[model samples]
Target: MDERLTIASAKANLEKGSLSAEALVGSCLETIKQGDKDVHAFLELSQTAIEEARAIDARRNAGEQLGPLAGIPVAMKDNMLVQGWESTAGALILEGHKGSYNATVTQRLKDAGAILIGRTNMDDAAMGSSTETSHWGPTKNPWDMTKVPGGSSGGSAAAVAAGFVPVSLGSDTGGSIRQPASLCGVVGLKPTYGRVSRYGLIALASSLDQIGPFAHTVEDAALMLQVIEGKDPRDATSVDLTQTTIPELIEKDVRGLKLGLPKEYFLEGMDPAVKKTVLEAVDRLVAAGAQIEEISLPHAEYALAAYYIIQPAEASSNLGRFDGLRYGYHSSGQNLKETYERTRGEGFGREVKRRIMLGSYTLSAGYYDAYYRKALKVRSLIKKDFDDALKIVDAIVTPTSPSVAWGLGEKFNDPLTMYLSDIYTITANLATIPAMSIPCGFVNDLPVGLQIMGKAFDEYTLFRIGATYQSLTDWYLRSPDTFST
Candidate 1:
């Protein structure tokens, strides 16, 4: 064993009686203890992994019905509430906060017999592109310690990359999950909006917020998705979808698959290296029997502006609960007005405060139509682009991010630049489509992700295509020996 096996390989070993879930969990714990100092991926680790392993073993011994992920240990982003564990959302205000109740996804994972590995770091309240905004500190990329892992779910992706955990859950609001997974060289999926319950996730942009999975292989991500996705009464936005079985999806070949290339995504000033990776991926798909064609999404140019407006507006309302009256920390104040001001001002980081102010202003009486309403209209158009394109193409392909993972502090100060990091991803969230980031190539020794956008509720197609590519290429199997201790 190479010490890092894909879900398929691990499960095979367990089924064949060559290894046990307990042994795998123990190895993972050892890896975390030895490597987390450099990766900075995990905020906490489950010391009781052995106990969970024992349960897994007992179930197997009993020949009882086993969930697909019976013993897989998975990391979870800190924003989602997991009972008895601290759910920080990587913000200073919620530093000591504990999850009073299990989020729907957490409950589902437990029900599926998956072990909760630990919580991972993220941008403060899931605000920035780089994990540097985290109160705990930035999650360094497992490929390069001096560079970022990519944010708000950067820690979760890095945890999987560093072998701290086999798979992890991340929330996306304007590319939080996909971008980080791209930069960290892991398989990350941002499912169509409403595919997964957002009940316990700390909201950043409610309309755009989505929970997703990150793993080293496409099948592992699919496995994780199976356990967490579905409709839930707790989240009114959650929608029921017909999921394609992973085993069947994985076996499906790419022959005759039509892949659409969005012209707007290949704009001027795009990094040469990033463009190269995307083009090479296109060629790879072509070789795999996919018919590639360039398609124009007319209103695609305005996706970022539209996304920024809608996201912040949703963010403002969603963050209103943190007024310090009910839960979490509160600062000193003599009156209610001062209390709200003090709590928010002191709680949110600079990037988060900026968005909140922008959101509040946009939704205010006079500016509502000019900003918020206009953005909503453009959002409709952008969504139509995907809907129309999917009519002809099975899936769309693009660069997951504008560039490879930059230095930790590179774009931290410039919010617009940081927001642009999600250029290729936000539109997927806006359109409520399934999108994924898989390792395509490297830019200057750093990984780049080839993003595949699927039709609404068609995550299976994305997985099928991604698995085909991963099967043909050695990218996913490559490790960062320089960073993963």
Candidate 2:
């Protein structure tokens, strides 16, 4: 069994009868068993993974038609609801909680014949930038066990990087998916805000959160997105994509395409090695006949500030339902008020509580206009910045994260420094545009990602540029040494 098999290759092999779904799923399960003890990427393994694989194999043997992802094994972030399985969201509040319904993406993947492997760990309530805040434990980078694999989607990214699965699902609210993918040296895509349905996902910031795919290659990521992208009646934010089809990303020609390099992204404080590697990638695109132009996003500097205010405000509202009156951890108290306070106090983590407090304060009387409303205005300006830039350039390119993977505990004590980690990725989320992180080069032996951003619902352009870049480089082909053993 080839442990490095990608979705496309795996599908081809399965179709040719050269690979059985059982063998493929078994290889991934074995890999997880051998490596997960040290990596801690998975929070729970799916009991039905092998059974599902057997069902797919039986159908194939009977000559039934298969979907694009038929027999492919997939891991999902714990925040996504999968009926009959635990969906803890890495928080103590929902420990041992079982999902009663399937998330739209989960159901879509199941319909496409992909085998659901397990749920991976993440930041508690998907609030932190690193997985260190997970109640269970942090997921270590596959490249170096001492370092972090970025988050709040760290486990999803780490699983793909560790060769446990070809693809995994992750949510990005201010770079949760892209930043982790950059650190893990894999492909992560955060589709446009309304491109995919959000029903059944444990909300972080309803306005900013987006579910996407993490895979070893751009094609695999695209394939997963294709299977899951579309509107659902259950989610009002979902947009109808019946008239517009996702482009088939083939590495044909990239000539005449103009890509922007935002001046704000290249500012000081960025690691010198990361800058050099990304610039080298830009040069490679230039050599491939694409044009690189310097662009200005003046409001980009304010994106981080605006995102923090808006995201927390939305998060506070979304998380209000978990006050122990419903289904989550509950603490006993003398009265109703005390019960509410005690339940939240004990059930929530420090970071989650802090954000809730901040959010509550921002939305309070007299402060709404000064903070939340103003932040919404700033968000508009940030979106306008991308709109203006896209009018001239086909897409925007930048480093996925300012630096490569850092030591597990390096930024735990300093929240401000940790916030800066998503400086490059938050802008795209704020703008509600599609963006992707593809492995471009290495810095001190750690992988660096080149992020490609496109206009709303324009994932095809981002995928085209990413696929083209991957075709000219072997960075995505490399894997952690632990996998080879």
Candidate 3:
């Protein structure tokens, strides 16, 4: 069994009878069993995975038509609800909680004949930039166990990088998906805010959160997005989008495309190797007949500050429902207030508590206009920055992260430094535009990602650029030696 199989290749192999769904799922399960102990990417395994794969194989044997992802094994971030599966968002507060119903994406994948494999680990309550804050434990980078896999979608990215699954789903509130994918050396896409439904996802920052895919190749990521993108009645924020052929759209040539290199994105403190590697990727596109031009998003410098304020303010409001009286962990007290205090104090992790306080403080009566309102205004300006810059260029390119993967505990003591790791990615979320991270090259043996940001709902352009770059380089095809056969 080929452990490195992608969704597109797996589907073709399954159709040709050269690969059985059972064998494919079994290979992934076996790989998880053998390597997951060291990587800790998965929080829980789906016991029924093999059974589901066999059913798909049986249906195919009977000559029934299958969906695009038929028989393909995929892992979902723990935040996504999957009926009958534990959906803890890496918080002890929701420990042992099972989804009563499927998230829209989960149901959609099911309908597409994809086999749900398991749930991956994440930062507790999706508050941290590194997986170190996970209540269960941090998910180590597959490339180097000592290094941290970027979070809160670290586990999802690492799963694809380690070849445990061809694709996985992750929610990006503020670079949660793209930053980790950059660190893990895989492909991660955060679609336009309303492009996909968020009905079943455990809310982190509702306005900023967007669910997307992690895959080894741009085409695989596009394939997964194609299966999941669309409006759902359950989610009011979801847009009623006309589905396009993403796979075919991504195959278009990059010639005549105008790519932008935002001057503001090249920060002073960025690692020299990362900058060089990203520019090399741009050169490859230039060689393919694409044009590069320097552009400016002046407000980009303030994006991280604004995002920190807005995200937490929304997070505090959204997490109010996780009190002990609900379905999750409970801590009884002499009074109702004390009960709420004890339940949250004991159930929530340190980082979660800190953010809740920060958010609450910022949203307080006197501080609302001073902080939250100002941040919202800054967000608008940042969006305008992207809107203006994108009018002249097809897409904006930059480094996904300022640096490669860091040691597990390196940034744990300093929250400000940890937040800076997402400086490049948060602006896209703030702008509500589609962004992607594709492996471009390496820095000191660790992977570097070339980021592409596109206009709202213009994911096709980003994918086309990514696919073209991927065609000219084999960076996406490389896997960690620890997991490689």
The candidate scoring highest on lDDT is: 3
Give the Å error, residue 150, model 1. Answer: 0.7
Better of 1 and 2 by lDDT: 2
Q: Which 10-residue window in model 3 sums to the lowest lDDT?
A: 243-252
Backbone clash count, each prediction separately = 0, 0, 0
lDDT of each: 0.87, 0.92, 0.92
lDDT agreement of model 2 with the native? 0.92
Instruction: Give the residue spans of candidate 1 off by over 4 A.
Output: 1-3, 483-485
For model 2, the run of ten residues with the poorest summed lDDT = 242-251
Which residue pairs show collisions in model 1? none
- Cα lDDT of model 1 by residue, 226-337, tens digit: 8888899999999876664455457547999999998888986579889998899889889989998889889988999998899889888888888877767789799999
Q: How do all models score by TM-score?
A: 0.97, 0.98, 0.98
Where does model 3 exceed 4 Å of error? Answer: 1-3, 243-245
